[model samples]
Target chain A: MLPVRAGIGLRHPHHREFLERQPPIGFVEVHSENFFGDGGRDLDVLGRVRADHAVSLHGVGLSLGRADGVDPAHLQRLARLVARIEPAVVSDHLCWGAIGDAHWNDLLPLPMTPAALDVVATAVSRVQDTLRRPILVENVSAYVQPDLADAMPEAEFVAQLVARTGCGLLLDLNNVYVNALNHGFDAQTAIDAMPAVAVRELHLAGHFVGPDCVIDHHGDRVCDAVWALHARFVAQHGARPTLIEWDTDLPTLDVLLEEAAHAQRILDRTRESVDA
Target chain B: MRDALAHWQRAFGAAIDGAATLPALRGDAATVARRFGVYRNNVRLARMAALRNAYPVIAALVGDAFFDGLARRFASTYASTAGDLNAYGAAFDAFLAAFEPAQALPYLPDVARLERAVHVAWSAADSAPFDVARLASLDAAAQAALRFTVRPGAHALVSRWPIAAIWNAHQPDAPHGFDFDAASPPYFALVRRDATRVRVDTLDAAAHALFVASAGGAPLADALDAVVAAAPHADAGVVLGTALRDGWFDDAPAG
Candidate 1:
């Protein structure tokens, strides 16, 4: 199990520093697809780092919400990696990325309807069975809101998925914040509807605010609102394994460690209050 | 509604592919188009980034605006068939070959091929190194019949253009005053992975033939004969010795 502390997403630029310094961060998360090669420097480096730190295999290519079903070849590669790494936690986003044989290579939002819910639940179950362990499903930031008249709330869809598949929740707070802002909803309400027991992890990342919408680019520092939301969730739901993700225009190791240090402070505060 | 979900995804995909302007999404038409534009842009940008990562030299050869347009056209024409982005750009080299705007720069296609080879060599599966002592242990006749295997992703490409020099010139910290003359002699590149880095070495005509023959599973004696035939004055011993020292060949496939 991952500790109730903070971690950082491992990017390519900081691999050497991570190997050499062996920072005191609680764990490190990596994009599962980046190391999916049969063998290479990325995989070799991941093996070396795994010996010292707790690692999380966070995936983006699973396409867990696709209507056509998950890709078997992708699942096979993921299974191979999991068998080798024995990661502390495995997780992927709740988004569809492909239709038929064409892959968009971007996380596309799914319509939050009953039919869509069934598709996602089945896919999640299949992935859990294949991995032989429960995996966490992260809520993605949606720019295109599903306009279906009978569309259920995003929280309801996720809650039902957890109940049906016995899967855990990787509650990405920044996604919640971004979606709330883009779609005009209450962030706290979204957080309140989450199945508390199923939440095994939390994600904090920065976003780019565009003309029509806010983009979850994972490129900047976490905003003040997201930080407050994270504190509230930790205080209410207690602490989970939280991660700071920065993907584009990556900064140095010191910056990521500093952000993680801030998260650790929030977790520590919440832990003390709960203990008292 | 099961059909509707799939239908919606299809329409949405069409919009992303630039086959249609916008899907029948909810909201005002202008607002919906504006929002949908974000997804369309994301799809194109992500695929373009993958191509850029694989062929940095190609991008460097053509400026950003031109490369962006070329990548956009290629992406729309060839849909990525795999979830792994690494597997997405294999056809870009071919796409560049038939591109009309890029005809003046004929070497671009070959350079793209070399870049793809470098990427494949970098990520291909690991293999055991060649066993020198075991070869000595074999009887002379047994050794002559032995067929060698190069490490996974190792490749030999002979091009009329100076593709290897162009690729090397674009690398960071590459020496200045590189002669970009298309009139220079053609180059043969032998791509191999050393430790973690992919090395692209220029080879002579005879050496290239030997590598191709050996990599094609030719018997040791037959491969050497081909090398000797290519250049009568070339010393077969020295050529094979250089290949061995460079960690080119993996252990011969089991019996």
Candidate 2:
């Protein structure tokens, strides 16, 4: 498969534009939960796009962090979708979104404990087994770091997940950037400690600067610092399939493509450097 | 480990309720509270945003402040049961019906019902229209005896207010000065996706009666008779023809 040069996180607002004029980009990704229904217009549109573009299924609602066994029904739905779409890459956040039956519908952090690690590892294995394919787990931006997680740093937690499940990592550089500022850690250090061999893909997105810290809102262009971090990531990991995600208050397709093109240029430069 | 998981779940729930912070398990109390606070905020924001997106008309009808408050209340009470937020607000219509603040807006429940229908129809399922050729191949007797099922994407909604008109008026291209009279008689609306577009049509009394009967498994002839009885001058041929053209039926004749 051609490497994921640069893709955009497809949103509903841009559906008409995408359908009308198939924009030039490396690939496109979508939130898996948005298409979880038995059948509907959403499925119809997705089917139309699947024929034209290399699509990726990036799930946001799997709640993989919940201690309860993964929801069998959700797994079955995702399995059916994967069978239907046969996306290039299937991914979900490395965060939990539910507790028992009550789903929070947000990516919640799991404490970095041996017990939590065991639970998360088991969940990933089960999901991979059911889907009959290896899945990539992406690190999410954190607003608060739990006390219990002190025993294990974020990088170690990610490395352990990759070790246990043999799943690839979608290192979201912007998330690391956001968390670094919010939690007062060095972003590059975190990236350096990650198991580079397992890093199969990278994510670049815009974030909002809040009063106390930055939030990974994915609503703007890639910041100077995040782009710098992306350059550093490519230096170590080579040119992986990098996705440019812009979720809230999305700009026109042209703007998003421009942002992606910038990433592509950086990737090309990094490839040259590595070749030398 | 299970005990810790349970405590975490409880603490998270309490945090949403503003009853307690995430308890310090292996770190400082302030850090735990702040970190856990992020999860709590995310849960509330995501669910609320989904509700707003699904019920934009409802949000517009009720001002932003009112809608946000209602959304918060619904989130705290229901707590999303499904991992998919697309299926999050299944109970919002009923909740709105009983909400004291919304009681004055009598048409609010119907609007909520319509919004839910749109959401369901949007994600219900992809289906090809019942093959016209198959229906034509059936003899007159077979056609009369045929029992058809609506595909998963099919939806039928009945409202006591002019909800269809109200819903259309809220669309992006709607004209100004569109007002609904609360005293208008109940309206029956049918929504189904031809493919990607949700087509909402208003059903006359006769067509509505026939559909409701057929949906309950009545035979075609009986349903026609019922339609004729309800509206003596109603054209059964026109109604059935429109339904067929709209791909409402999912099958032809059963052997």
Candidate 3:
């Protein structure tokens, strides 16, 4: 098994470079939907990468928040991919991206009410049963609060979800940072309340600061505050697998590796402190 | 909660439409509205960007501003049905066909169709190329009776306008002095991956006819006859030879 060190989100731009020189990182992750096709350059490149490193399948779609039943076609495609890739970990966001037949194509937030919880938990449980594996569900960075949601805090909602479903948690420290800043909450408090045993992975990505909100854009380097939260997460969780995801305007491979190395050093230091 | 979900959905829709004030919800209404708005923006941006990426020629034909407007309108009207954004723009060609503003550009629909084909081909499933050597071992009669399937990722696109030529000229390294009118009449294009790069080839009349016939499961002899009939002046032997060499066929014709 690959250790709990920093990995980079493998985007198309960096595919060729990684092929030529397999960089030294903890592991690599790719958007599962990107490889949903049968045969193509995307699949070809991904196949090559799988041969060389431990890969994690991160899904952007799957719409776990929808009130309707899980999309059978989407689950079938994901199942076919899991059989083929045999990834170390598989994950999707806790937010919904589709409603009935209409897909919004974005990670839309869910109401934290009991009704919404039942809907999302049922969806996640169905997916886990189908895949016969405990998939990790990542907390999405939200921009707004719905009126019908239960007054419970986001951390309490997440904890409730972990208790209801056996699925592991993919604690996105960056999302915690973004939501904390946007909604005027403490990022550390959210992290501290996370059910530590349910957390199997961590994600640290950059966000785009908008006029009214800080968006989880994943298009730049991890911010200082997000890094600090990530370090704190490692201290709390004992070095779970962390991924540095940069989707748009991706920098050179060296720059991404440097970011990963920074995270790796933090994890190493934390591990040393624990041993001492 | 149900009402709240509906309200959030509507607010998200309104926000994307550039509405100023969203309806108040139950929780932190302001925060909910803001988050919903952020999602709306991301949805619009991502879907429009996918359309632009898949249909670059359409974006080029209609300037960036016009394309952006069209993308936004299309996204709001045509609800995406699949989890994958790549699967979002299937109706774009038909949408373009009926779009009032684009009606003047009669060729735009066909161009959009070709672009969709290229996008689909780029993401289609992988399959092994047909084995020519294995086919050579079959008896002549069996060969004539064979039914061959095109590779899963291979797509045949036929358009009345010179759309493939338009697509080819937009390649990253295309020559600056290329002329669209210099290209011949309506042509058939075979879009498929050659190793890693997506390669587009303008198929002759006979090859196109053969591909269409074989795609419909016609036997080799019947398909060859249709090809010869479609382009009486073209050489069927050379067309088949080229197609076989290009990894277009998926298997030996079924006897």
Identify the candidate with maximal TM-score. 1
C-alpha RMSD values across all candidates:
1.9, 2.5, 2.7
The positional error of residue B102 in candidate 2, measured at the CA in angstroms, is 2.0
- State what share of the real interface contacts each candidate retains: 0.63, 0.70, 0.69
Which portions of model 3 show Cα errors greater than 4 Å?
A: A149-151, B1-35, B60-66, B100-105, B179-184, B252-255
TM-score of chain A of each: 0.98, 0.96, 0.96
Count of backbone clashes, every candidate in sequence: 0, 7, 16
True contacts kept of 2: 0.70
Task: Give Cα distance to truth, residue A225, candidate 3, Å.
Answer: 2.0
For A174-210, candidate 3 gives per-residue lDDT tens digits of 9988988977888898789888878888888889998
Tens-place lDDT per residue, model 1, A1-276, is 787889999998899989999999999999999888877788889999999889999999999878888998999999999998999999998888887988898888888889888889999889889999999999999877766556888778888898899999999999999989888889989899888788999999999999998999999999999999999999988999999999988999999999999999999999999889
Compose the digit string of candidate 1's lDDT tens values, residues B108-139.
98999999999888778877668777778899
**Which docking category, incorrect, acceptable, medium or high, applies to candidate 3?**
medium
Stretches off by above 4 angstroms in model 2 are A1-4, B25-36, B131-136, B175-184, B252-255
Instruction: Kindly indicate the candidate among 1 and 3 with the higher TM-score.
Output: 1
| Candidate 2 positional error at B129, Å | 2.9
Question: Model 2: per-residue lDDT, tens digit, B1-255?
Answer: 745765775576567657764554444566556555656676778889989989999998988999999999997788778888878888898999999989999889888988888878877766677787887888888777766676555667788888877888888878965665567577888777766777667777887877776777777777788789888999997877877787887653433
The better candidate by lDDT, 1 or 3, is 1
The candidate with the higher TM-score, 1 or 2, is 1
TM value for model 1: 0.96
